[model samples]
Target: MAAARRRNSHVQRQRACADSLAEFVERSPSSFHAAAAVADHLASAGFARVEERDEWPAEPGDYVLLRDGAVVAWRIPEEIDDTAPFAIVGAHTDSPGFRLKPSPDRVAHGWRQLAVEVYGGPLLNSWLDRELRLAGRVSLTDGSTRLVQTGAIARIPQLAVHLDRQVNSEGLKLDPQLHTAPVTGPENGPDARSIIAAAAGVEAEDLVAWDLALADTQAPAFLGSDETMLAAGRLDNLVSVHAAMRAIVDTVPSGVIPVIAAFDHEEVGSGTRSGAAGPLLEQVIDRIQDARAVSPSHRARALGASWCVSSDVGHSIHPNYPERHDDGARPIAGGGPILKVNANQRYASDARGAALWAGVCSNAGVTTQPFVSRNSIPCGSTIGPITATRLGVSTVDVGIPILSMHSAREVCAIADAHALERALAVFLAGGWPEHA
Candidate 1:
């Protein structure tokens, strides 16, 4: 009876997480917004902002820092008679969408709309027939920043079915310049600067470099008659990022090393200086050691003791194309966090690390699942392998199973958020099973 009650309570917790994640995405217009929002969450949880400047003593404690709109946080354990290992959780803040290009002042048929280029992998068809809005940061010549927010525009007119009689028989094909183009009336009237100026409370000509993307006008909502599913935009990895940040904050107060990394540019390959594949994390670790006044020898030891969990979206069994998934290893929505694996080293999960994750779930009493691609199909990857290799730490790749991954809007079971959070809480608090 007690176990059942506990499970039910956990479910409620997960439901709250899903709602919070949706809210996060709704507010985070771009990666910059996402990182800022995450920083706020960490601050609210009592983590002092860690800054990078020069060398200093590093010790174990709770810390949060950001690099070019990417956030990374961690909790340094107080019971560090020995070097404490990091319970790292990572996710990307960027999602698939179109970015506004400079000098997008073109008008065709007396319609004025900004020019945009696709960023990351996205389902071009889903974006065709929906109301869209624009939001992002714009840089000023004075070395200051401003935000540009455009109201909902239904300018991207999709082709009607009546115009294409064989639409149902043949799949939809979209052209970036044609089908996805937005119609803004009278381009001759104003330029990109003017559109940005209206939003920034400044003159249009003052607008400099801008980073903007189209977003679905529809807010996230619960789906299904029973409300078992949650639908929202940018859930591909944002869900994981939100959960991990929360779990890390919640665990850090317990005096544990809770590290949360929100890397930038994952969708386009994480090779940028601010990305997970770069030296940002390593540099942060060094700063922590110096801040704590730890010696060089101890810093090396502390690093060796750390562990990482790379959080990203894993493929859920798609109902429309079940054959694309591995029959023996399918992850279902609402089934709990999925452990991703690949023999080609796409994901960082090895048999040993996989067992550790299972242990963490078991200890937390959080239900767990697995995801493996079919032998014939290639697997997509996350930062797990990259981080593990860079730091020489044992890493596990895990995430909530999501449908329509890389789509403009993604879906996932409402209950899985809590499962991942609970499991992460356990892992962050308990340290490694062998040491425990």
Candidate 2:
């Protein structure tokens, strides 16, 4: 009876966590929307919003900062000072997709299309014939920007099989410029910008500039016979974002400062002002130290004691392509969170960091798996190395396991997602013995 009760409780938690995650993904269609959603959620959780133009609060409490498409939130304990070490959880807000080009009006043949360019590497074929929405922010002539998203108004139609006899066996080929323009309406229908302006409650002519992306219109849903799995778009990094945000919101006061940094433009090498490659994290940390009035030597001491956990999604072994993964170490869905390892420094998980993560998970009563790339397969990078190198702090890369990563839609085990949040909560709340 006890075992049965425990199992039932775990199932309920998994479903509840997955439902909340789906709701979050539904609200965030673009990087800007993701950042704004984080800010709003933090506000509701009693975090005071601070702007870059104003002076930061010195008193110990919860605070958040929003910079364009990125968000950084921190919790300061009442017993803390400028010399307190930081317990940082890092994640990214952006995902791979197509961005609408300026002056996207196009009429090719009898079809009216919205011109778009590939923003990042995506599974091109996965986008074909899927209902897609246009979402992002548009700058008005009056210097104000509004977040907007059009209902299912466009689609990238795949060529008919009858017209392309070899599409299945030979595989479909696409030209980013020639084949990827999404058909919005009939050739004589309203212009793309006009449709977009209506969504933002402004005239087309009032739109001075805009940044938009094509996003899948499907809502996340449960999969499998037991309904223990979730399927949704933007699961690559949003899973990490949602997990870290929840952890930070529920964090209690501790000896170290708990921080969560979710940045944009990570899909395109993270070189922008709001990305990990830039100085956003560093600048925010410096301002925080200044407001607390810590001396230089103590600041250095705090820096040495700080630790970061870079969270993102990693690939799960595909049943059909099992050989493609490292035979020795392939994480699977529902196997709890993964500790990513790469001797090449691709992932910043050294022996020390791995030990720290293991202890955190163990203390949280969470199981974990290991992930490594096949020698022939070059591994993808995350914000872990960037944060470690730039900040010169101990860092580890960790994430939940999911399949069909980078697809228009992806799938992950609900249990794994739930386990990740539980583990993150422990890390943020200072379960590790050395965090102070």
Candidate 3:
């Protein structure tokens, strides 16, 4: 009876995690919005905001720091000596999409459309004929900014089947410069600034500039015969961000300090002020050390003992394209979280980091899979190697297996998201044995 009760409890927790992910994706339509939502969550969980310009307090409590589209939150253990290491969970908040150009509002040949630049490597074909909405941060003339989302305000219509009869034999070819523009209306359509102003509850004249992107209008939903799958946009990294946030917020800290670092601009190259390539994470670590008045030697020792789990989505074996994956290391949709390894250092996982993550998963009663890209195919990267190289901390790359990555929409098993959260919570709670 006790074992049965424990099983039921686990099921309940999994259900909660899955439901939370759906809500999080729905609320975060863009990278700026995602960061804001994470900050709100941390604040509600009793994490105080710490401005970078101010000195950090040395008290043991929860705290968070924010850059434009990035966020980092941590909890100080009640007892603070100079020996504790940092346990960090890192994830990106940005995804591939079309960003509006400087002169976005254009009318040509009686059709009013918005010009856009492809922000990252998106599946351009997947965006054709999809209803889209605008969402992002709008900078006002008064030097203030507000988040806005005009739901289902535009669309990219495909050419008729009769007009493109050879489309079946020859797949559709899209030109990012020409065919990807989204239509809003006829020649005399409503102005884009007016629409943004109305949504933001500000005057149209006050809208000086904006950082806007077109997002899918379809709400995320459960798929599969038994409703065990998730279909949504931005799942490539948002899934990781959500899991990390929950783990950091819920886990009780041990001797090690737990941190959540959700960065932006990762899809492009992570080169912005709010990206992993910037100095935000390092500055925060330095501030923490200064607040505690730790000596330089002790600080170096603490950093050497620190570990980071870089959370991002991994590719799942496609039933139709099985040859694309390594036969021995392919991951499945519902197989639980995956540990990504690459000899070329595309990923930062080494044998020691892999063993540490495996132990965390084992302690959480979760199974894990390994992923290595096939020899012929080139592999993509995450923040793992960048963070490790920049901070000199040991790092591992891990995430839930996903399909249709970088598409306007993607797929993953709902159960796998829950499993990843459970394991991440264990890691953040410092369940791993301390290094001698």
Candidate 4:
């Protein structure tokens, strides 16, 4: 059984990682498409779909739903007499990328163009000198809508090497407004009309609204000679979401009610209705109250008994930028999942939660790593802190250590995918003590 589990984990990890990167690239420019992909997966797993307004009261059963690309799914144990304690694993689906505003149109000289705003803190240098395409959601004249990722819309013209002789020595400075505008065509070029026509599915004159941004068409691939590393786009939190899904699916049926949530807009701080810091999770929990009209007292008791794991991405120790990391707490790519800590309470992991997570790693036979920001340096946070406090549940923040977090393309150890799955499975299967 042990060997078989290991073997199965290996296969599952490979398939999950590959599928994750592909989905990440395909569903860019909006979390809506990303959520749709997750909905498809849950549907395939025998989970039934439920609408919030429908008269059929939600009972103790597997249910899933998506909102503007954010997803929340749960399984209600068959024997639930009232509100059962939730074993929840949460991750965000959105990554740092440029977003097209409603009025994306602008004309320069004779060329038509689209305007975009930087969505999150992205590595400006990594975006240079790459083939760029446009993608996102588009609302039509009718009530129905569609996602448009037709093809490469345009490319931000890079300064010529000859114009700047000392280009390599001087590095680069990016003016988002001046240099980032992709040139779709010559002034009044034929390509301009073609792009507008393709986006609207009608003549250029009939187009109403479009939200499009640049994307690299290259597919994700396994990195390193031993294939122990994975390289692809949007690893910030999608990697965590993918790992949580694998873990929940693996251990959900072991008499524990496993829940996996992929919320949108974490990059901009989760302060929205569909964000992790919002009521979507609580609403889903409320839906589980149909079979036994759960009261406020019972709900509080269930919440106190619940456990949550907020999954996000952590910065791996970069070889070239060794000085940027703490000397004693360098998390390597293949090290394992990281237990993030913050003295100022940026991360959700506290002493009690850390110990519980440590035990999960031990039981799963996976190594564990630690991540703490340097005392002198400021720190970045994740959905962990928000979800913990918002839901009022005992929570820990964890993630796969990766390089180039929040960039269009990020790198991570391939083996960490399997390691995270192992740890999360142990967590969902339950045995950890409760905390206040």
Candidate 5:
């Protein structure tokens, strides 16, 4: 009976994680919304807000910082010293999609369309014929901003099969300049900005400028025979964001400080002010050290002792295209979390880091898999290497294995969400023997 109850409890936890992830993605349509949602979650968990312009406090407590489209939240133990190391989980809040331009009013042949630029590397063809919604922050003439979401307001229709008879054999080829624009309405219909203004509860004339993106209107759903898989948009990085947030919220405090660094602009090489390559994480860490009045030498030592888990999604093996993956290291969808390693340094996971992560998973009673891109195909990079190089800290790259990454929608095992969260919670709880 006890064994059965334990198994049932595990299943319940997994279901809870999956349900929470679905709600999180539904609430976060753009990076700005994602950051805002994260901030709200932290606030509900009793984390106090800290503004960049204000002086920080030395007393240990839960605090959060928010940038334009980024958020950093940390927990300081009541009894912390200069030698205390930070246990950081790094994730990105942004995903690949289309961003609306400043002057988006365009009419082609009686059809009103919105001018948009590709924000990151996306599977352009996947966006064709999908209903799209606009969501983001809109700046008003009064210097105030409001969030907006116009549901199912636009669509990018694909060329009919009759027009492109050989499309199936030739494969769909799209030109960003010509084929990627989404039609919003007829020439005589309402202007795009007006629609956005209405959704934001403001007048069109009161809108000074706006930052917006096109997002999928389809709601996330569970798939597979047993409904064991989740299909959703923006799963690549948002999954990591949600997992890291849950870990921090659920884990009890220990000697080490647990931090979540969810940055924006990672989809475009992370070069912006709110991105991982920028000064956000470094600035926050410096301020923490300053607030605690740690000596320079002690700060350096603490940093050297710190470790980061760079959480991002990796590719799961596709049965139809088995050759695309490494023969020895293809991860399956239903498997537990994956440890991504690239000898070329695309990922920062070295032998030591890998071992550390493996130990953490073991302690959590969660299985793990390995992922390495085929040598013939070049691997992609993540925030792991960037954080390690910039902060001089040891880092490991880890994530839930996913399929259809960078597409209008993506897929992953529902169980893996709980697995990744459990492992991260263990790490945050100081499961690492060496660190302990």
Candidate 6:
């Protein structure tokens, strides 16, 4: 009876975690919104929001730094010193989608459309026939940026099956320039700028430029017989982002500092100023050290002793395409979180990192598995290698297994996501025997 009660308790906790994750994803339609959402979660948990130009608090406490669409949050232990190591949880805020192009209003065949540039490698076929929401930050003439998210106002309708009967067998083909433009309404309707400005509660003329994306209008839901499956948009990385945010918010730092780095532009190769490849994470680390009166040399020692868990979604063994995965690399949904491995440095995970993850998961009482892509199918990379190379931190890549990774909507096991959260919480709290 005790074992059964424990199982019931775990199920309830996992369900609650899934619900919380869904709420996080629903509020984050774009990278900017994701950053704000993370900030909100951290602030609610007593983290002070520190600006880049302002001085960070030197005393030990929880702090968060927001940089445009990216955010770097940390927890400083009461006994933190110059040589204190950091257990960092890194994830990206951006996902594969269509970005609204400048002067995006278009008219063709008496139909008004919005021109959108492909931001990342999205499954184009899944985006068709779905209502899309316009979301992102718009720059105003007053030199301020405001996030705007309009309701379902546009759609990329696919060619009817009667017109293209061969689509099922031959596969649907989409042209990003021609066929991917989302139709809004009749050509006589309001322009894109006007509608977007209205959403931002500003006049059209006041809005100068913007960074917008078209997001799926569908809200995340729990599916499957027992409601253990999570279906949502942006699960490719938002799941990891929410996990990191929740973990850091609840963690009380021990000997090591806990940092959550959610950067933008990961899907576009993380080249932007707020991306993992840029100076945001590095600068945040240095700033934290500087505020604590740590010298550059001591900071280097801390960096060398630090560990980063690069969290992103990994592929699950698809039922219809089992051949795409290796024989032993059968990462399944509902099993647990995955430790992504790539021998060619595509992933940052090494033997030592794996052991570190094993120890963390063991302490957290969460089961974990391994994931490696087949030899023929090249594995995609995330912010892991970038963070490892840029900061010289011992990094390990880990994430929950999911299906339809870059689709308009993705699915994952709720238990897996919850397991990831539990493990991340343990890692952020310095559950690994020692800080180093």
Q: Could you tell me the lDDT of residue 103 within candidate 3?
A: 75
Of candidate 6, the 10-residue stretch with the lowest lDDT total is 427-436
Q: What is the lDDT of candidate 5?
A: 0.92
Model 5 bad stretches (over 4 Å): none
Q: Candidate 2, residues 208-320: lDDT per residue as tens digits?
A: 88889999999999998999889999998899999988888877847788999999988888888899999999999999889899898998999898889999999899999
Task: Give the per-residue lDDT digits (tens) of candidate 5, residues 349-378.
Answer: 999998999999999999999999998998
TM-scores for every predicted model:
0.93, 0.98, 0.97, 0.90, 0.98, 0.98
Clashes of each: 23, 0, 0, 4, 0, 0
**Would you give me the overall lDDT of model 2?**
0.90
The number of residue pairs in model 4 that clash at the backbone is 4
What lDDT does each candidate get?
0.79, 0.90, 0.90, 0.75, 0.92, 0.92
How far out, in Å, is residue 179 in model 2? 0.9
lDDT of 6 by residue, 222-334 (tens): 99788999999999899999999988877866778999999999999999899999999999988888889998899988888889999999999999999999889899999
Q: What's model 2's TM-score?
A: 0.98
RMSD of each: 2.4, 1.2, 1.4, 3.0, 1.1, 1.1
- Quote the positional error of residue 15 for candidate 6 in Å: 0.9
**Clashing residue pairs for model 3:** none
lDDT of 3 at 134: 93
Cα deviation in Å at residue 254, candidate 4?
A: 4.8
Off by over 4 Å in 3: 1-8, 434-436
